[model samples]
Target chain A: MELEELKNLWTELSDELEKQKNLTDKIIMNMTQQRYTNKFEKITRYESVGAVICFLVAIGILWKFEELDTWYLKLCGGITLAFLLIMPVLVLRAIHQIKKLNILELNYRDTIVAFEKARNHLLMIQQFGIYLSFVLFFTTIPVASKLLSNKDFFIMEKEFSLYVLIGVVMVFLYFFARWGYRSYKKITNSAENILNELDNGV
Target chain B: MTKEQKFTELIKDNEGVIFKITTVYTNNESDQKDLYQDIVYQLWKSFDSFRNESKISTWMYRVALNTAISHLRSRKKQPGGSGIDKIVQRATENEDQEFEDRLKILYAQIQKLNVLEKGLMLLLLEGKKYQEIAEITGLTESNVGTRISRIKQKLKSRILKS
Candidate 1:
């Protein structure tokens, strides 16, 4: 095609593209909203599972030392159990606030944005899990000691061993959480780089 | 100018760039819409980095072509049959004698080229110089000349037979 002919063809194509811009923008907007919603839901679900596990742990500890009758012991156990049960519910409610949005299948840029948002959400949840595990680990010692003292249920050596076991588990959890976050960060960064290249027209 | 105003001006001025790339790269209504939107979104995301180094139109072309090439590569791995088949079928069914039949034929032929060849022909069709084409395509100057000559001959024979 001659230069003029190519220019004319491009002009026609440009007119068509202009007409479609509003529609494209709407689709991208929807996709972003949906991505945020999906991330919120996934994070909520993970948190809820964590909360349930904490609740079960609290119940097991209580059952193991039924002989503990002090008011202080009862108060501490109840407060811990209540916290375990409530935190996940709060996270789930927060997730529900995330809006659902549409993503156009053919739009590669929008698709990349959606994927990046998802990866970030996953990393955030992983970090939250790590933080929660640490909180539980540090608080468990004093609570466990109180219950044991109230009941006179175990020798000092046995109580110390239990604390050591809990410490080991906490350390393992911390390392695992850090690894998960690092892997997710790497993937997200690579994906973002590809996105930037596309944006740069490279 | 405000960012929104600048964006509006860019769209108004370069709408054709988006359209031509979409038209050549996609065959159907849905695919056309998809490609068009993808191009615009990419442009919007990259608008900040456009350092006035080259003509905006040239930058647009490079981005559009790169995105189209990547999309084509990914689509090739999809399990279903080729999407171009539907486009060919649609063109055959369109009985409008007023439409440029030669243009449709040219598009069909262009679709058959490999990704690199398609990029070259796309630039060639746009009347870009061999040097500019080499810069965009990462091919040496002589290689670009040889490829364009070869492509021209091939297209001429195909047109003659048709």
Candidate 2:
């Protein structure tokens, strides 16, 4: 059939849908009222909320930093505050990149490119977050030992158990990073394939 | 009326666009409803920027097309995410068998199209001009003309083969 005939059929299908009694005002109202928040919107909201919370926590820690008496505690406090300060900026930048993706304005192809870039950027942020977490964990021990020594709870002596604890954390960090990268790869690879399909044409 | 009330009214007027786009993109009844709701959600998300710069139908087409395409791409990664399955059967419950058969053939032909071609064909079927199709699709007018001509030829040849 020609485009004209097909157009006729198309109109018929639309008219059929229009005439259906089930397509009532109530259904339409329900659909409109529904907060069908897509995944990206939810992610953006979570990131913004997380950034605010992180900012507040960092401020609180800096405000209370002087109370930490031991040298190692002060060093760890500086490190933690530095990390906390840096992380919100990165998160805010990411949120900005995501918000800038005007999918409604860009052509379909440009939209795909923009979305992929944003996804990759987010993956990098995720990797950075995991590494920072490992740093925080490792740094916590020195701070804890310092506090313990100050209290005479324990003395700093190099021990096999210390080596064992470090070994366990290192192993855990390695697996965590590996798992994170794999998850990141799975999503980005899927997005890449879709973009390739669009480029290659139908 | 408030901005949201106006949006709701505009949606009610152009709800068929959602139905049409969703039908072209998805084969399952459940997915069709999911895509319909999703398109409405997306249109609302971007409604503040509508600004009367384009006709209401034109704006609706752009939002619906983008939402439908992205929805399909993401649906591939996680199928069956929309849990509600049985809602749209009532809409199809009374379609005459003859009309149903014609729709079947039409959708079958559309299914054979690539994603981009499906969008073009859907726009063309809605009687959009090549200029507007170009604008909505981000293809040049000449590209829209050539591809649509080719699409027509392909559809004709498929009809002949069938």
Best by TM-score: 2
- Please tell me how candidate 2 rates in CAPRI terms: acceptable
* DockQ of every predicted complex: 0.06, 0.35
lDDT of 2 by residue, A1-202 (tens): 6788989988876675566534455666677679566656667788778878877867766666666666767878688777777876786687568656776777655665666677678778877888898887765565545443443113456779878988998998999999998888888786687567657654
Which regions of candidate 1 are displaced past 4 Å? A1-202, B72-96
C-alpha lDDT of candidate 1 relative to the true structure: 0.56
Looking at model 2 chain A, report the run of 10 residues with the lowest lDDT sum: A146-155
lDDT by residue (tens digit), candidate 1, B1-162: 876567666765665555556656665556665666666666666778878777776666766675564332222311221233322222245443323443454466667654456677778777788877766655667878887777777766865776
Cα error of candidate 1 at position A129, Å: 33
Q: What is the lDDT of residue B87 in candidate 2?
A: 19
